[model samples]
Target: MSEPTQSSPTRPPTPSALSSRSDRQFEILILALASVIVLVFVLSIYLLGSESWPALQRFGLEFFTQRTWNPVEGVFGAVAMITGTLVTSLVALAISVPLAIASALFVAEYAPKWLANPVGYLIELLAAVPSVVYGLWALFVIAPVLSRWEQGFFQDPARLALYTSCKNLWDSGSTTLQCFFVPSTFDGRGLALAIIILTVMILPYTASVARDVIRLVPQEQREAMYALGATKWEVISRAILPYARAGIMGGVILALGRALGETLAVAMVIGDSQDVLKSLFGGASTMASVIANQFGDAQEALHRSSVVTLGLTLFFLSVIVNYVARLIIARLTPKGIQ
Candidate 1:
């Protein structure tokens, strides 16, 4: 049989065999770690629901659609807080996304090594700053700067004629709107401050992640673009942007979730007014802020359960928004493996 086929002993497990075994063990360990994390949130939801199932099921649809909150009477509606949360987050996104992407592009496309690294560090440092500090700065400094935008936008009789005629913040004129603008931090509350604080809070994470993604576009692709005589802007718009689109979008969704769940900074600046208003400058309260502020002092079963339900709502909203953002971006992407 061909000299017994020169039987060679199956060599003792090689390094590759050891490596594969080690990798499997490591993967199992990591999976255990990941599973432990999933357990916490799952358990939390179960416990929270366990505590409030009856209340959640009791009012049901009325609990959500009703637009009034009275703790003494136990008639709580989440409409205002929900609306405020959505509005403020949208405002933050509207303000920050373009700026964040632009900054990312600058760092990835234009800035030299010396400039990019230092500036990238500064952007990261912004994320490290405490939310309360951002709140304090926004209240003490930025609010006054932004408080002037109200009249400038709402003043035209023909433009925003739907908005009721109202004087500036100082006049104390009974306003359908909670805030009118004349540049004052004396009140220490306004949507302007909330938006600015949210923007600052989101900018670093969004921009930094985007910059990393943009950097991942291969250098050869850029060289080829230049060889084709594409202009700088044209190359970015065509090559870098399309390549990094998904990653940039992922960053944006994460940032949106951050803005939605943000509590302290928004709470500090939101003026915390319950009355819904017609203007962007109106004082507002977000769902997270309401939860953080009231969860401690909510002394009744009905009250506590209602707030918990609101918490669930906020959580679901974030989930849905991020999901939709991902889906939209995915659809826009060209068909290929990224």
Candidate 2:
């Protein structure tokens, strides 16, 4: 019976000894690099933690929420700076995202290739300039320009009506016979300046990445939507945005990371006030610029430690923001689909 049975066909060679061996080698190399990257991250966190742990222990969580930052009293609260950083970053993102996506869509879907490259380069060049230049530009050029413009916008009667109450309008026995005193010039330096400069800088990055995402969308997908009676805008809205949401969010994440760490530009434009306020026009410090401006001159050890702690705070906030962006994109991604 054994002799009668046909001999089994020869089996294939082990993958370990054949084409898959190269894959294994590449994977091992990638693992080694990944390990190094992880080690670097851990080491940086350890170093910062070691340096700032004393201040953290001394101040406890109170350091984060306190308003005052008195060095003589050893009192340090990051609340204002934290508020400034978050608010300005949010403003910049709000200003840039819609424009960036729109530009990307237009370039990828509507604009001629000849026009797109030059325009894209022009946008990208903004990020190439030094931050100090941006800061100077903001202070000298951008702030005054906005000061003039927003002075009118904020003073508009329409805005006054939109407000919950017109009661808050200037009412110092107004020189005018008007019932509601029109608002005057707002602070040109603080959030307005920071947001504008940040928007300019982040535009290149956000637009570039978004453009790439739109470009990656298959032509066939757009055509199929068109075949089903979709207009160009409809096709992009239904097909392109749905497919490229993750990529656009990734760009936003990248821009946010860049904006948060920005120092010189923010420092120059964000009027150096320690006070926190509900108004975006209120001047305040940010963690990066504060440390940059203070660390070298900080006389006391505790003061230096506090500045370092601010740096650590910035790092932590950045990581948290990045994680949140990832979670948002993940949630937005279509399940059981690419």
Candidate 3:
């Protein structure tokens, strides 16, 4: 029995086995790196919160609801700023989404061969232009144009007549109207102008992402729709868009995020006022714009804390918005569509 015990030799791992093992190791490494990145983000939030606690504790909940922002008196609240930020971003999205989608579809599926590349390039080029330059251009050129248009429209008897009915119901003499209404003849540098600037800045981002997603639609799916005697519009509306909607949504969310955080251009064009105006022609300040305008000059402890708190608010708000957007996209897009 002892003499019959013969052991089999151990075999070396094959090339494929080694390769797979190494690939898994690389994946694990990348995952660890990503975890570290998340940790850093958490740490940044912690620091900002800690720095902002002074003002948070001082102002309490009033910090969020109050509209006054006076640094000399050490009084601050971000309601108006938050409202301005949300309004401009929403308006920008409303204006840009249709234009961006149309431009993307044209470049990806309909433009002549000679025109497509140039159009795409121009979109990218618009994105490459500096924010400061856009601000300068808006200040010098677009602002005056907008002012003239606004004044001209409001000065028209027909346009003024249309608003006369609402003016009575809304009570133009009330404090509410005083806080919001801009007299229609007011010059540029308000919510509408900021929205327009943000739209221009964000257009390229959405268009480029949409075009890429449209290009990702499987050729076979499009062919099948065509074989079913579908028109070009039908194929795109029925097949291409449904397949690429998730990606398109992601792109729009990114553009919205950029619009929310835009600082210099918004600061330069938003008139740097803390008025909580509901009208597009009324001047208002955004969180980013206020921080850009006041951070350096904020020598008071409370003033500095308030600015930091604004930044912190924006950071957390962005995270929440992105999470909600992802959930919406996931719910709207069909299973296995992406």
Candidate 4:
């Protein structure tokens, strides 16, 4: 009779329901945070554009095309700054990309765990170093060494002849072209130094990203390659790199973004010259560097607005670069990989 006593039917716990609820909460939290980031970006663009409208009205389209920048005369043009920004970033990429990829391959695929951990940590730590500190190092240490090296490297007769020919082909009205024909004074306080410093600064970021992307290649893929009698280099070149190309391109764009936006280090080494760089050895100014140098001293409303406009240009450039990178990544990624 006791055993026959009725008991309430037990129900199993609803694990799927709990998981679904948790996932929805997480998705909502993530969506809210992402919305905050977009809001901040839009707010920044609005504020900058509002401040820069006066300059845009006064200068019209010439603000972008003209090269002259005189605060006293209420005249300003951003061509030199824009050219410096583009050249420094491009040269930095050219110098750093190969080194970064090589370092990533070595650390991620070849190094032992003991070596990889410390090396990777050190690479990441380089990004944490202050830009001003890098500036100081460039000014004192690298500048002197580079100044010496430039005498032999840049002043060669063949190189100068090639440069002159290139300059002749450039438009006479081109501010960037005018920079190339300038007298060769190798002070090592201009584009060359900026490019080199930027290369060093951006290398860590690119390498770290590439290393992670490369490491993401599944072990099974590598094993399959190995079973096919693939050499280490073949596996890396064909399997790893092909699979990771999209992510690597993304890393390069991120590095370019950093280079484009760099202010303190570039300002310090670029000689703070508003002139377009005629030579890599000459002093130059970038949009970010010019803004940093002049923002505090800008007295006139137009002057302040011009600086703000430069900031806006940099923001737009970053957005465009990232967008292009995304497109490239999408193209490179296979349907299965994503």
Q: Each model's C-alpha lDDT?
A: 0.76, 0.77, 0.84, 0.86
Which runs in model 3 stand beyond 4 Å of their true positions?
1-43, 154-185, 322-338
Better of 1 and 2 by lDDT: 2
Q: Is candidate 1 or candidate 4 better by lDDT?
A: 4
Better of 2 and 4 by lDDT: 4
**TM-score of every model versus the real structure:** 0.75, 0.74, 0.77, 0.78
> Candidate 1 regions off by >4 Å?
1-35, 144-188, 319-338
List the candidate 2 regions with Cα displacement exceeding 4 Å. Answer: 1-40, 147-187, 322-338
Report the C-alpha lDDT of model 2 over 153-268, residue by residue, as the tens digit.
Answer: 65667775633242343223212224222223254777667888889888877888788778877779999999999988899899989998887888898789888999999988
Clashing pairs in 1: none
lDDT-sorted candidate list, best first: 4, 3, 2, 1
Off by over 4 Å in 4: 1-39, 151-183, 323-338
Tens-place lDDT per residue, model 4, 162-199, is 55765664446444554464434566688888989999
Worst 10 residues of 3 by lDDT: 176-185
Compared with the true structure, the alpha-carbon lDDT of candidate 2 equals 0.77
- The prediction achieving the highest lDDT against the true structure is 4
